[model samples]
Target: MASPDGNHRHPETNGEAKPPAPKKQKLSTSITDSEIQSEFSHHDASVARINNGSFGSCPQSIISAQQRWQLRFLRQPDSFYFNDLKAGILESREFIRSLINADDVSEVSIVDNATTAAAVVLQQIAWGFTEGRFQKGDVAVMLHYAYGAVKKSMEAYVTRAGGRVVEVQLPFPVSSKEEIITEFRRALERGKENGQRIRLAVIDHVTSMPSVVIPVKELVKICREEDVDQVFVDAAHGIGCVDVDVKEIGADFYTSNLHKWFFSPPSVAFLYCRRSAKLSDLHHPVVSHEYGNGLAIESAWIGTRDYSAQLVVPSVLEFVNRFEGGIEGIKKRNHEQVVRMGEMLAKSWGTQLGCPPDMCSSMVMIGLPWCLGITSERDTLKLRVHLRDRFAVEVPIYYRAPKEGEVDPVTGYARISHQVYNKVEDYERFRDAINKLVGDKFTCASLSA
Candidate 1:
């Protein structure tokens, strides 16, 4: 099969390389609001999408590229799937490697999403434990603020393998990086005292609920000093929001969702296995023909699923690069906008920011006053529905649980996401809507009292 670069080679047979294909002409960088909006077909113009963090919005151009690949798959089926797909996917892997500054393209694999990538790594670790590579009482360290689904996956794997999960309690409205590092060190030391081997530490580059950027590099350093065997950096919200250098962070495994920040279609993400980690035993959750072929091929063709999302990555990069200041510029604007919006909302709600400004990225968690009556999960859900239904504003309201066995009051945060499509007026509208709701609720409670 001919590669995307026009080099002809067969996976089953070795052959001479052909001349590279002509590169596609670059699109003009002059993009307007209307043009950009038009490119995002999935955007609901009627509703203010302040919740880009939930599921990323893709550009229409990238969607077009995905469609083109889908059409090719539909037309050729066998030839495209067997011959052409590998080259395109390899190219995409290289793009991902460059984006995150990975040491080599071989270290990267295109997975379904960050969640799937985490599952893959956990499964491999579980296998190792069962095969006696890891002991029964080994510890898998995690933070209390990890994405709920990921935490559950880690627990399932560790428990099934007779290993225990050690959760480092991280406070909400976290004050400083040192506080987190200190807590993690305590957990590591405690594990050591108990004669348990700390095998894997799943750290988030950017946490989900509280929306704070964890000091991953510092945490990695701590893990190394404490003799933690492996580190998995869950960077689901890291890539486009903040600067991510996997090579520098030096985690054993790194996974991030390109769909969330790179403006690609959903169900697309990348996983990086550092060469020194020697985790070549890792495979997709499902075994297929490409099983044991190697990480790149094993992850690339996982059960003949649609490769449109992976194939569209190049276009997504190109489209995002054409943004006003490129990826870094886009991140800068988003961070500034969210910080401003968070400050405004926090002031309007008469509450403090969830975390310091330095810890925030494109997403900000603005504390919702306790008086707002959104203390329970049901209450938070109702508030979310109210914001969407009454104000046409789509935003996530997170209810932070009190520490285990603690009697502290539950806190609420309106985690707002800022992207190029969002405007200052959108956040102002959200602020006004929330203020009215909280004010009315407080008045009613006062009357009842």
Candidate 2:
């Protein structure tokens, strides 16, 4: 039998199948950096990939496992679909449930990504609004910096259904966690003062553009106190970036992308719907034969698609265990390396970090030197293209227009991501590339021309 980690394991001896062995714990000591980098030799060594946060790079072993599954499907579609797919998905969910400390396997459903999960939850809530469970002008609170897709999802479903969206304007380059908590609380209270009942709150585990770790758990607790009807955590960068204990957080619904930081293939994420939430009202955005059934069954078969990524969760978990302290150790190493690299870049550019070290996870947002003339989102995009095409450096450039009462009129940042395969030289390459561009007097206008 093919094992999750691309190894072969004998499941039968003397024509009798053996019981599956329990997964072993992670090793205490991790492999060397060179050895880790060797796992992704398939990638282009010429390009410095420092944007692992956007779309994670899978290792060759996991790719082999996925290809094996694909070949198995192609060999005999009937046997693969009838006998293998459902079991494989359930097995994947079981592993993820344990990883997130979810109370039951039923609470977790595998979907393409966090966007689909958001649609599932928001559509259900929209249905609730239609049924008169919520009044017109009911508010759905979200941070001003929530993922763009998620905000669009809420606007489409909630706002169009007689509900309203209220944004909590979180301070950028924030000084402390207390500031975030205070702002969140104030948003909820201010909405209530305006006679708008805050029906829901969408919180991020980590902000994408600015790449700071949010105090989601504390925010959830505040939601409970504020009597917000429901809370959904868009933790797209959650699973491998930090220790996510879903049950401990006690949010009504939470979704995270396994592909972002969990070493899974692209387009696979898990949504956790608390058993106590309105499960009967929730349904998959794509209606399948299992529509009336629970979300786990409904989401499992969302019309014939690439199910290989979802099936390889066991293999992903196995790959994670190969490192020391498992995901915990990986996160620790990534955080330390990313912070050091971020500081290095800030010093090299004569700029500063967007937030403190503790406010970040495996990614950090470092201020780009203002001399580069990155003044707007368009400028950030142009500079990003220039960096990728000219210097073969892949990093995210973000621009934050100054909000009211801010010191700086314009702010630009480079959000750098760190993963197991990354080394100091990769970030140094980025730093040197930016320095050269600045030294060469390249500006956003020059790139545009």
Candidate 3:
């Protein structure tokens, strides 16, 4: 019942792209990877639940920490009416900062999710400025890989400001690092015409759809050379999967959600504002306490709601270390799992990797063609449902539409996650399920080889 979005491939009964090759059918009753893929099952019946959700709701290490906080919610550790919640938030930010190797934790601000982080940064840029911050035609460039919601936000921002958004047409399964770096450079150059100096280049460190890890250092350099006003990295997927030190990347602004990959509670994210950036106008997503000085966002951090999720961040870091593997060990394990899954999925479905295996970060996006054999855009919903109903798997998919003569070499892709609880079998089952849904006889000879 899932429909394709405008950005993805249109429905076609026939085209050059082909369906996957069918595999022999077998019964599946277990949670093993093979069973999940080959068997026609469902996700709802597969596992325990939390927060009325699946992945984020799992009762894990971080939840234990939240329990401790809940036992004492009324009692603030500080001497005031509240306990030491402020101190707790600081500690959480510090924990995240240390892992990412950031120089100052002060630059980090807590939020509910990655989207909030994006809104905050955009708000600061859109409203935090004096009239001098921008001239009439100044442009901001966003990527096609950005989450759809973020794209919508940018659209509204530009339309209101008399500015424009130029989407960088990126290629998937890119062959070389040079190509990625070049694409970013070209994007900035494209935004520089009409006296618009590409005022801001809001890019994704690890794009959500394909989960491609960008070379931020080089891209930042390009933006600077292009006289782009700022570089904002929406690193929603990069936080836990890879090293995300804001100082190291030198992006003017950055945001990451702890809930997605970090396994931290939902509604928790952080923003990293470069020291010199003018953040005087973070007006609080919701007007809570008055933020007078330039420290509005940071000051507003204390506004409301139970700060339990943000407070639990430190515990999540500790838990990641508790794996006995430490942070490095956790990262390696996760990265390996994703890569392993990507290889198998490509083989089973006959589709090619959407991004380089190395570019993947414990999360992968593998391409899919239209049902009619035409290279199409991504149909994440259909993939999600098929994986669950037929394979008992639960994962996200992203679709991209073909652009005019630039027919997408590959369109639909399923973005896979390999978190701590995931096993090799989980990936195997995912591949099998894809074969079942897409029906095995498929090929992408031009790209796969």
Give me the candidate number with maximum lDDT. Answer: 2
CA lDDT of each prediction against the hidden true structure:
0.81, 0.85, 0.61
lDDT of 3 at 9: 18
Q: Considering every candidate listed, which one attains the maximal TM-score?
A: 2
lDDT of 2 by residue, 1-449 (tens): 44345444342322123334336555666666676777789889999999999998898888888988888888888877676677677767878888898877778899999999999989988987899988888889899889999989988999999988888888878779998998898889877876878888999989898788899999999999888989999999999998799988889899999998998888799999998745657889999877877788889887877799998988888788888878888999899999999999999988888899999999999998777777778899888888899889999988877667855444789999999998789999999998998898877877654
* Candidate 3 lDDT trough over 10 residues, lowest sum: 1-10
Task: Give per-residue lDDT, candidate 3, residue 358.
Answer: 79
lDDT of 3 at 119: 71
* Full ranking by TM-score: 2, 1, 3
Which scores better on lDDT, 1 or 3?
A: 1
**lDDT order of candidates, best first?**
2, 1, 3
lDDT of 1 by residue, 165-246 (tens): 8888887888898888998888787667778899899999999887899999999999998889899999999789889998
- At residue 442, candidate 2 shows an lDDT of 76
Candidate 2: minimum summed lDDT over ten consecutive residues — where? 11-20
Instruction: List TM-scores for all candidates, in order.
Output: 0.91, 0.93, 0.78
